[model samples]
Target: MKTKAVRMYGTDDLRLEEFELPQIKEDEILVKIMSDSICMSTYKLVKQGKKHKRAPQNMDTNPVIVGHECSGLIVEVGNKWKDHFRPGQKFSLQPALNYMGKLDSPGYSYEFCGGACTYCIMPNEVMELGCLLDYTGESFFEASLGEPMSCIIGGFHANYHTNKRNYDHAMGTKTDGNILIMGGCGPMGLGAVSYGLQFENKPKRIVVTDISDERIARAKEVISEETALERGIQLLYVNTAKMKDPISELMAITGGHGYDDVFVYVPVKEVAEMGDKLLAFDGCMNFFAGPSDSQFQAEINLYNCHYTSTHIMGTTGGNTDDLVEANQLSAKGAIEAAVMVTHIGGIDSIAEATKNLPSIPGGKKLTYTQFDMPLTAIGDFEELGKTDPLFQKLSESCKAHKGLWNGEAEKILFHHFGINPKEL
Candidate 1:
């Protein structure tokens, strides 16, 4: 099948192109893309092409249909694929194709299936190890966040190791401990916020520290305001660049005792070192993001490390199991995965959407322009018996407004959103 997709040909350059792909094999299925939550990694691919070792390398150029974080409807199924996938189930795309690399996977590494495209062939590995799932009425956009959700779920599932302790401690399941995430306003960091404060068992406090006040304010919009107050999700805004000692600033926020668990999302050298200094006894340090060339070193005083019983650990992409847990959480409404995505655009608007990705005012960035309904309108999914007209209008209006986004906020009524005010 030939589908319209965002084709990446080089660094900082992308375009809407038509690509030819084989039809589903007996073991495959065809998916109609519903929603794509903009992945930071996908943005990274655009900024730094080819260098991403796992990115598809085109000898002709550096073009690849670059998107992994997505959810879609199963349109067609192969003879062998029917047992697992129905004709129209909402499912997240498990795009990271290489797991142990036993054989070729359609959407993990080089030939990864893209969520950015309108349609794709769901490979065999995707069906067998399908982390992607959707309830009856849920929008693809809501389910699309599953990829990011899976990664966080994976990191949380990892048994964090520390030389200070005799045994490996699980980072994600802690309840009584103090959870502090540095640079917690970003997408990966915010996911930690949702997982810690909303989904995880009763956390003592989900404290997020970031340099930007704007980002902190935006973060508050996604997570519950009342629940955060009730559950003690204190948002800490600090200017690390101005602080003589960021550790001291963080220390003050934790009432000078330091953190019980620190999830470090920012990869800046000094920020990491600062995180190491503020670890309390038997505390776990989770380095969530990776450094550019592996030269990024986090320093800690040896005596303090040994005496303080501090453990430092890092994790990358999660295994398939985490994806499964994420789906359940989404289905149950614990994480509110779908609502976190604030904007929805389409393939032609890829460039515009990416420009806003780095500075998204709220939680998740999404691409749902190609779809038929608003994510919210798809609720009560069990009866996938009928379509909603309101959703159709919203989706179509989103596409129309997307075409008119010229950086200047012009007044245009989105017929679908029913927001017909003269003001945009």
Candidate 2:
């Protein structure tokens, strides 16, 4: 079968083209993609191309599709998966297969599988490892977001405290302890905030710092302080760029004790060092951002690391278990996956939208594969509503849900602008 997809050939070369797909083998499954969310890592891959470690080499001969955050319906199930999976079942993927410790992953390593395409094949390893899961979420977007949410979950899991002997250790965040989230106003930061607040061992106080006041304001809109208050958790947003002494303010908020858990969401050296400095005694700092540069380095105090027991760590993606937890939490409304989405568009916009993702403001960008329209920011839906009737409908949907997109909005959009099923 022939399908359209966004393929990365080299640096500055992402092409939306038609290509033929081979028949699925007995050990594989074919899926019709419903929704795919653009990730910052995907943008980085576009810029780095063959230079990216996980990205396939020789793209000029065999270009790979470029997306991993996606959800879909099974159109054809392999004989090996027939007992567990069936045609018409909805599913999402956990792309970090870690097969034989290989760096292979969908969107980065595969030619026949990726989220951005109209259709994709799930290989035997994915099925055997339980990477493909049945999705019972309200919307396909929520399923697509499961991957990013899992990364945040994995970060929280990686955080730990060590005793003086270093023999005794505790994993996960400190319960009822003060926490700091640097660069916490972005989409992934919002996810960390939402998940952190609703965590089983929740923090007593959470301080989110960002350089942009506008982002801080948007963060408030996405994960409201009122909700945090209702949960009996203190939530504070700070614009450190405008502060004369932001570190002093942060220290004062924590009563000079610093933060128990500090999550750094930006890849910049300065931000990483800032997060490291905010760590309290026996505190854990999670460098949540993945740097584009291979040789990226940041200055950290070795004295504090040895004497104070403060440590730094980082993780790239989540495991299958983390994805399952993320899906469950989002399904139960414990985490607001909708808050992470700020833009929506059709498949035709994938190439340009991905090319300019880093420059674009706001959260995740979602695409409906079967539609044909320019990318539209959720914030501009009201303005677009003045001229376009469909956007007017979308505006109403978002307004009804407290300015956030939801399953209802997805239904309205698909009803009005989605392609007919018969056409596919």
Candidate 3:
């Protein structure tokens, strides 16, 4: 079968090309991709290409597809796996497969499998590890968002605090405690906030800090302050760039007690250091951002680590369990995955969209594999509606959902784009 994908040949080298897909073996599966959400880590991979650890070493000889966060329909299931999986089932993937202690993952190591492609083949290992999960979500975008949401959930699980005796330590964020999310208006940060608020061990207060007021405003709109209030949670948004002393302002918000849990979303040394300084007694700081450079370092106070039990830690992609939790929460409406999306486009625009992801001033950029359209920000739907009737319908759908992308908007877009679910 013929398929199209955005392949990465080298650093800053991405191409949209057509190729033939090999027939699926008895142990393999074929999927037709629907929705894919762009991640910052993917941007880093685009810039690093062959130098990336998970990236194939001989990209000049064998280029690889570029995307990890995606969802699709099972077009053809292997005969050997007929009992476990079937055609027409919707599914999402957990791409962090630590197979044989090797860093082989989809979108980085796999040539035939990646989220950016119209169709991809799932190898035996992916099925053996249970990395592919059946999704019952309302929209493909929700399933695509499961991967990024799992990363945030993993960060929360990695956090822990030790007692004075050091005999016992509590794992995970403190319940009913002060929590601060640095750079909390970005795509990943917004997911962290939604998880933090809706998590079973809910916090007493959540303080979200960002440099852009526009982003902060969008965060509030997505995860409504009224919802937080109804849940007895105090939600505060602040632009640290406008503050004389950002740390002091954050400290004052906690009434000088500092934050019990600090999540640093920016990978810069300065932001990590700032997160460390804001830690309260027995506070745990989770460096949620992944840096591109290996030698990246952040300074921390040793005295605080020893005397106050304030420590910092970091985690990479999540495991299979985290992926399942993310999928379940999103499917149940316990968490809103749509809030992370701020832009939408089609597969044809992925090449240019990825090259300029850092410059794009919004949250996650979603791409539809079957559609051929220019990249459009969600905020500009109304403006674009002036000329296009489809965009006009999309704008009305999104506005009805309070400016956030949801399943309703997805259905509208799919119908207008001529994607018949029954046919798929």
Q: What TM-score, over all chains together, does every model reach?
A: 0.78, 0.97, 0.97
- For candidate 1, the TM-score is 0.78
When summed lDDT is taken over every stretch of 10 residues in candidate 3, the lowest stretch is: 415-424
Give the per-residue lDDT digits (tens) of candidate 2, residues 1-424. Answer: 8888888888879898888889999999999888899999999988988888788788878988989999988988889889999887889899999898888888888888999889888899999889999998868889999999999999998888888765977889999999899999989999999999988778999999999888888888778888899999999999889889887888899999999999999988988888888889988999999888889999999999989999998888898889999999989988988888999998999999999998887889998886677888998999999999989989999988878889888888778865443233
15 Cα displacement, candidate 1 (Å): 2.3
**What clash count goes with each model?**
12, 0, 0
- Candidate 1: worst-modelled 10 consecutive residues by lDDT: 404-413
- Model 1 segments more than 4 A misplaced: 59-63, 100-112, 131-137, 159-173, 199-201, 224-226, 232-246, 338-342, 355-363, 369-424
Tens-place lDDT per residue, model 1, 177-263, is 567788877767777777766645455666677788667666665564566777665544455756787777668776777777777
Off-target runs (Cα >4 Å) in candidate 3 are none
Task: For candidate 3, write residues 1-424 as lDDT tens digits.
Answer: 9889999899999999999999999999999999888888778988987888889888867888889999989989888888999889999999998999988888888889999988999998899999999999878999999999999998888888777665787878898999999988999988988898888778899999899978888888889778898988999989989999988988999999999999989888988899999999999998888877889998999999988888888888888899999999999999888888989999999999998999988889999888787889989999989999988988999999879888888888788888975445
lDDT of 1 at 109: 39
Query: 333, model 2: CA deviation in Å?
Result: 0.9
C-alpha lDDT of residue 204 in model 3? 92
lDDT of each: 0.61, 0.88, 0.89
Better of 1 and 3 by TM-score: 3
Which residue pairs come into collision in candidate 3? none
Candidate 3, 63: how far from true, in Å?
A: 1.3
